[model samples]
Target chain A: MRRIMVCVKRVVDYNVRIRVKPDGTGVVLDGVKMSVNPFDEIALEEALRIKERGEADEVVAVSIGPDDAQQQLRTALAMGADRAILVKTTDVVEPLAAAQVFLTLVQKEQPQLVILGKQAIDDDAAQTGQMLAALWDRPQATFASKVELAGAAALVTREVDAGLETIEVDLPAVVTTDLRLNEPRYVKLPDIMKAKKKPLDVVELASTGVSAGETLKSVLVEPPKPRSKGVMVKDVAGLVDALKKKGLL
Target chain B: MATVLIVGEHDGSKLNPSTARCVTCAAQISGAEVHVALFGADLAAVAPQAAALKGVTKVLSVANPANAHPLAAVLAPQVVALAGPYTHVLGPSTTFGKDLMPRVAALLGVPQVSDAMSVDGPYKFKRPTYAGNAIVTVEAPESRKLVATVRTASFEAAPQGGQAAVEAVAVSVPLPTHTRFVSVSAANSDRPDLQTAAKVVSGGRALGSKENFQLIYSLADRMGAAVGASRAAVDAGYASNELQVGQTGKIIAPELYVAIGISGAIQHLTGIKDARTIVAINKDAEAPIFEIADYGLVGDLFQILPELEKSLA
Candidate 1:
């Protein structure tokens, strides 16, 4: 039986307007709400697709954050993961350290294939999957738009600048899902109820011997001034002339 | 002292124009000894170009058959292994760089800073967040080394002066087992590379249809600028996904950026935050783009674009 692990992150829903606090330490999510990151939901979909096809025997969803992140795990479970693991940490973990926690979880889970969103919505540093592959000394692929099971290995199509490139790698590899990978499914009310009863194992980051103190040394965040209004041009010719006059053409 | 490893992007025999810009960024961060690593089958043909870039003290050429087609998975580990001695690794924020560097940083147990515009200290770097709407400075403390992908347009490609000595390093790395490139289909366009272009012309959903995007193309061609589009335009099928520029799409920072019929959303603004000058042309005077535009024009883009094209002609 093949074991697949999908990493999920709880983030401020993409639709919300996230404001960075003046302290630059955390974002102020006042009226805005949070949810599982969109890309990670795509990752979860890919994992479920593999399982639905019988390519894998079991699918597990994992997340590293505070207890509130369990919501994301439940979201993944509702999407069809067999179970979930929540590596509880205080606040957000730096990208590298988060990768370390992922490495530890991978060691414990021993899944044949690991998948993650290309990057997190909040940090936007798509490094965890790559770092996990490196630390485990496993072959890895990033930004995969498609993945197919080929014998004991996986054939993946990755999106690049020029076009798509297909690669075949052995199993027990790390793959990061991109936006083009697959459309994630919406959790039906029935599945949402089932997810609440699904088994969720919570582990503390300190238990893994990884210190968060040395995680984020230098951190800065600032909010951009809101855009006011835009001006419309009359037509193409006029727009061109206007831009030229402004030295922007 | 921590050494810095800078990856050089080249087409077999020639280094990319942005390679120098990455080298300059490496030089800015203290405790860094810059080493340029060139990978491909045609290292000898590419060596001279890598040697010509200033601030590159040493060049390591990895020639192998597996490297003929560059992929992030194949290149990430090699970068991590070569980064053994360096405290920081730097690469240009091109598609290849952006795809590979973060993976490399993750492999080496270091935090990877993506699209950083400035570096304040050894591990502290400032990068645009929220698509360029705001800036965030971050520090990676756990790992001894730091990896940063520099926005090419934000830094000037350093002048070529001193010729560095090139060393032929045999490709000792194991062959990539998981993935291999089957083929690549390149799109031929008259526009410059969007990430490095000095000027960019973008359109939005207000253009209404795919045919209308021709106005953006014409203006871009007239100005010799790259073409871009808002997410709404791309989703509306007015332009290709490759042309989309927003929070969820490609980020660009050019000398000048022109937005026609785009109501600057925060997501769209994040992508163009580094552009030195911004000009917005839209029909709605109260559109969000005007607040950030250095010069704002209130008119219909359909009429303004053609006029701008004629003036340039």
Candidate 2:
């Protein structure tokens, strides 16, 4: 492969407990730390490894969001991406519009391989990669646990509902990562410094001619109702009693 | 009034329970004419089950040899072609449905409402974000067809009583060939599926190795519970990815969840928050798993596991 692209997203760190805003506008994100999505990190790590293995000439990291999302793209560069592109969008760019933007990039960049996280931890839509592949009429392998590149095809092992399924997609395919694909390498301070000088092109999302469809829109936001106060049983005996009393035993 | 198309998830022979759950989600739409679509090598044994779902108006079958496998590329266009006049198209939010429904939505040039948790009307809906921490209510435009994947966990299965009409439809959409099915190594199990199971017993990295995981299976077998594991255990090579119950893995809401030696990361807790009653057994007294647990036993799991098993037996 000559060039490979990795799609990343900036989202709430996996550790923080997300709370809803009192106004029901959205989640409280005033001060929450945002990082490269964990699954996206794995996807970028895979692309970097593919480049390091001399399988690709360069690895490009792409993200479509607000300007702050450029920070996530820079993190990808620190992790060894050759370059980055930020499709800056202030609007809540839904998956379809995001896919259209990526499609524009695909036509411009012409990367042989495109890899992305199976789903973003934020919206959890998990649709962009699949939608992109379909719009491009390219083969797609979603929830891939393992991906191995050969001469003209990629052997992808996917985590499906039934179990692990392995499929072979021809070159120029979209691969969405599942967890356990690989342990993303930690970026050192020196790499971060090096990434400061790397090329990161910011493109206006509106300039791409992609219109957000009328398919879906958010109207309200709320936190999941917390479970009732639960008792800590002294032993298994108490557990059984609790279950029996609830008619669940 | 909207005609909602419910895509049936099946392995050719039996319909996945999530399909019925998707029907339940569709039933929430006011004046919904729900239609269930079955596409496989043979729907002889599965069509009737779809027809029996309450609120369904019809069960459409597309029996094509190519559909022996649920390849998204092959199935997406077929669903799109049959989705004519449908104001809404829905599938269960499972591995199969997640893989299939989005492509169908895209092929129709419509933005898909994924993981929809509740329905207010034909276009307005609620869905979870940030891993179920926040539920966002959204509205799709009324001019075009809306497509969604129902969060099967949020609704119970539709009651089975309606005698929906069964019709075999002929589709001629040219299927994609670039994506081909090779072989699938399914984690064959006789116990109830982890997603649909009433009770689940999950182990953690403390299980040590793949062999020690047998204890989890033994206990789950005795309890007639499905087996699940933490991402750490799966990453440590102690279990398959299918059994990993976490934010990145399967999101399940079993009635009785027994977590053993799990440190209860927030990501892992996201998978089981909907569980009715949770029991945690761990050596660490302050493992986060205990925070939401209905019952906690702070002790050595090595000793407690055997004792608990013997008591249950």
Candidate 3:
């Protein structure tokens, strides 16, 4: 049976307004609620599709975040993952260390394929999946728009600046899901109830012998400031004349 | 002793403009030697282009039949092997570099830094995180080799004067058998590439229709600029997905960027933060694009663009 692991992240809900602080460290999400990132939901859908097609025997969802991330894991389970693994940490971890935790999990789980959102909504770095693939010394296909599973390998097509490029890599490789991948499915009432019974494994970050505090120098949080509003022009001709006078045209 | 290796991005015949930008960035760090490494079927054609950059001291060319195709799988191992002696590896933050740099970093068991706007200390660097909203300074643990994908627009392209000597390097690793370029159909546009273009003109949902985007293209054409679009414009079916620029879309840093009718969402700003001079034309004085813009015009882009086109004409 082919084993597949999908990584998910908990982030500020899309509906909430994000405010930047003065210091430029982080954002203010006071009244705003948090939820699973939208892109990760897409990743989960892709994995579920493979499992539904009998392309894989099992689908496992994993997250490296605070205990609150269990909510996202539960949602993944509700969507059809067979199990969940939460690499729990009290403090926020940096991308480098978070990648190490994922690598450790991969070492233990030995899944034939690994999948993750192209980027988390919070950091939006888009580094972990590619970093994890590098650390494991395995080939990776990132920003995949389409994925085709083969007997012992998979053919992945990625979006590039010049054009699309396709590559076939052996199994047990990593593939990061992009926004163009698929529209995520919503959990039904019955599946949400079934998710409560799904197996949930919580592992502490300390158990991996990786220091979250040490990995990151410090936490910098600030709200993003609003941009100044400019005047709107009524027509193209007048705006052009205005620009030409200003030498901007 | 910390040498920097730049992976050449162009087809073996010419030095990509981004490579010159990468060279300028590497030169900013003191005591770092910048060398350009070329891999492909033709080294003779690519060497002079590498040798022309101002700060580049050496040009290393690795020629093999396997490199005829530009897949990351074929290029990553060769880069890893070539990067053995250097402490830093730099590439332009384009689609190809974005795909290959991490693999090289992973091969070296180190973290790959993405979209670095500026570097402060020698090894410790400052890079944007959370989609350009915040910047972080990171210290690599004892690892000598650091891999970074440099944002092309963030740095000035290096001057061309230095006499860089070219030498051939050998590659023994076999290429992957599964991947090959079947065919490519690139959209032929008169405008410049959004990433490297010095000027860009973008539209948003306020444009009302795809036909109106011609105003953007006309103005861009007059100025020899590239065309871009907000996510809203793309979703509204006014522009192709390839032209979209935002947090989840393509990041662009042209010398001059013109935003037309865009409401200035945070996601869109993240992509254009690096543009040296931003000009915003929106009806809403409250539109966010005006905040970061170097110049602002409060008017309808529909009227502004055609007038501007006539003025340029």
Candidate 4:
């Protein structure tokens, strides 16, 4: 079957104001709103669109996180994925190990394309997609704003610091979604109900034979230093004068 | 002694300033020897610039026809081949390094430290997460090679006084053919690049339309500054993708940053957090951008921008 595998991550909702704990351990996550990582949602949306456009036959949503990550996978299904897979794990997975897990699944699933977010909002690592492509020994098009399937190759327009860079990659490649890709569609209530019946499989991290390596030890997490209080300028003239005094004009 | 290999970025001619920033980060390691690697079809014009960085001890130039365009798949193998003598492999956190470094890490079978804002120790680093709202201190394994991307905004560019030897290294790794560079559509602007500009003027959705964004450009041009835009402005099509300045876009630390008609979303604030002087011009007096701004002006940007331009003139 012509299939596209989309990887979604459950993270703190984008709108929430994340606060670090007073103990310098980590951010407070108790009762914080959790949703699909915004970039991953765009990835899933692109996968579903390709399926809808008949460029592919099925869209499979996959996620590697706690068991609660199933919630995000269900949201993916509601957004029009054919099925979902949850690689259950309680510990936080680093990017390299996460890439290994995806590589393992890719061997079994054998999908034509693997799509994922460029970076998770929580860690902002932005490494998994490229690492996966390297482990899989396939082409990677990261920070993709546009993807078009043409025959056995896909044309991807990437958002880079230089500008809009367009590249073409053969099939069985990996693509990472960027912010400008597409606005994800909202899931309807009826689709949510229907998604419950969809085949959502759960696999243990141990069974995948990929150990989540803690190559990096977390020393501590702290809030960023607060900026000094600012002065309010009355008009452009005052602002210009203030800047000139600072030798910034 | 810590041996560091810095992957130099360039456009086939001149070395990017971001590479010099990486050199500054690499030089922070105690008892360190820093080397830079440049890859392109021809490095005749760029190799000297890489060797001139003050802390750089050597420059390895890998010239090949296939490396003219930096496809990560083609470059990762070559980087891995040259990975033998280095304790750390570092690149800039810009888009080029973000795309290429992880692949090198994976190929080397080691985890990568992305966007290292501070070098705590040889294996320890601090990076920003949650869109720069939080900082995390992480220490990689000393047993393995450390691969990291240096946050360019967090460090100054390395001075150009060194006379390191430039060597031509022949890496005979098989390059991948699955990926091909089609073309790049870049804005042919005479203004300075947004990432490295000393001064920047940015607009937001409040500009209303792309035409009104010219006010930002006019003011920037007057000040010899680069033009940037909030993600909202880019989403509204008031600016191009490359002009975006925020967490999801370019993180800049220009000496002076002017945010006109920007509501100062946290994501946008993250990008300019390191800027030396911040000036916010917004109609809303309570915009969060004013909280961090050194100077805040609450007024209509339409009238203020013109007056600001004239006053500068």
A229 Cα displacement, candidate 1 (Å):
9.6
Fnat of each prediction, in sequence? 0.57, 0.78, 0.34, 0.92
Best by TM-score: 4
Q: Model 2 segments beyond 4 Å from truth?
A: A212-215
Chain A TM-scores, candidates in order = 0.92, 0.96, 0.92, 0.99
| Cα lDDT listed for each candidate | 0.78, 0.88, 0.78, 0.95
Q: What is candidate 2's CA lDDT for residue A39?
A: 89
Q: Is candidate 2 or candidate 3 better by DockQ?
A: 2
lDDT of 3 by residue, B285-310 (tens): 87778878767788766776777777
Question: Relative to the unseen true structure, what is the C-alpha lDDT of residue B104 in candidate 3, on a scale of 0 to 100?
Answer: 74
Model 2: lDDT of residue A53: 84
Clashing pairs in 4: none
How accurate locally is residue B119 in candidate 1, as Cα lDDT from 0 to 100? 69
Worst 10 residues of 3 chain B by lDDT: B177-186
What DockQ results for candidate 2? 0.76
The candidate scoring highest on DockQ is: 4
TM-score of chain B of 3: 0.92
Error of 3 at A126 (Å): 2.4
User: Candidate 2 chain A, which ten residues in sequence have the lowest lDDT sum?
Assistant: A210-219
Candidate 1 residue-wise lDDT, A1-249, digit = tens = 689999999888887777778887757767668798887899889988998898899999999888988988988988889899988888558766777788898888888899998877776766677777777777677778789988788888876555466777788898988777888998899999998898999988889877764455546677754544435444455555665676655
lDDT of 1 by residue, B1-313 (tens): 6577888888775677768888878878775667889888778887777777777778988887778877777887687768777777888877678777867877665667887777687778787654454577777673567778987766778778748888877646765656666665556676797767889999998999999889888878878899998978976878866777866677777888988899988788888876877888888888878888867888867776677677678
Q: If you superpose only chain B onto the true chain B, what TM-score does each candidate give?
A: 0.92, 0.97, 0.92, 0.99
lDDT of 4 at B113: 98
Residue A227 lDDT in candidate 2: 77
